[model samples]
Target: MATFAPANVLDFGGAQLIYELASAIFPAVKKMKGDYSLGQVAKLYYSFIWITSPLMFWGAYLEIRRQSDSILTKCKEKKIFFVLFFLIFSPLCTFILLNFSFESKNVDDIRVYLSFHSRLGMPVWGGIVPTSASVMAAMTAFGIRYFCCVFD
Candidate 1:
């Protein structure tokens, strides 16, 4: 019989790993994505999936690859494997996005968030955010993203 770690152990480990990744990435992410948009949400999700999750499997994948005789040949095989995986992965991602998107498809569904962003009105937490501060935040976010994209 095979033994396994407790489910809570695995869950807590995964959550800690994700939290660390978020903490490390938060500076750049905060710079690139300040507002609540689809782009910001996508960046956050993909960064967690691609950058963080890979480390969990990287050692196992490398061990599997090393089963092959030649180093160069094994790397080539691994690359091809991931490429094919991504070919399937991307479409599945799109399908999930499409289905979830259609479920709450209306722009109005997110209108409350958008309206909160407006500089004009909206009492939040018993006080309205000043228009000048909102405008400044938007402009700063735009300028930061622009410079980072253009230079980096």
Candidate 2:
């Protein structure tokens, strides 16, 4: 869950980190006439977010259920939180992707889409980065407690 924020920023915030990583993996992307543009990066980011959003909920459910003795009890307790998490980000990302104009294949032509998505995606997801940090801290503590049985 905490990962959502960073992933969001890397994908939509015009950081080009993802592009750099991709270039490293696929050397052709860095070649003379390779199709390595912000537009291609945006497409990759969009696909990544769409695929991973639902998986976050599943992973959360599995983690929550693993920690709890009773499956039904934990599901009942965390159901609303998980649902709300899915509801909020899914539509926002979808709306941003839908509204972002991806008409052209050229990097220059897709600046509009890049700018629009970045403008909206950055602040919105950036505000949640602190929350994600807190979550990571809490999850780390929970993991330590669970594994070591020191806090049980």
Q: lDDT for each of the candidates?
A: 0.34, 0.40
Q: Write the per-residue lDDT of candidate 2 for residues 79-144, one digit (tens) a residue.
A: 554334434443444344333323345545444334224535433442332234333433433333
Q: How many angstroms is residue 89 displaced in model 2 relative to the true structure, after the best TM-score fit?
A: 14
- What TM-score do all the candidates reach, one by one? 0.24, 0.26
**RMSD to native, candidate 2:** 12.6
What lDDT score goes with residue 53 in model 1? 31
Question: Which model scores highest in lDDT?
Answer: 2
- Model 1 worst lDDT window (10 residues): 121-130
lDDT of predicted model 1: 0.34
Candidate 1 local lDDT, residue 66: 54
Query: Once superposed on the true structure, which residue ranges of model 1 sit more than 4 Å away at CA?
Result: 1-21, 25-31, 50-53, 56-64, 72-152
**Count of backbone clashes for each model?**
0, 0
For model 1, how does the per-residue alpha-carbon lDDT over 1-152 read when each residue is reduced to its tens digit?
00122223313556446535764753322232323333333233323533433353344344434542353353344655433333344345434432332122244654334322232212221021122222333333333333323323
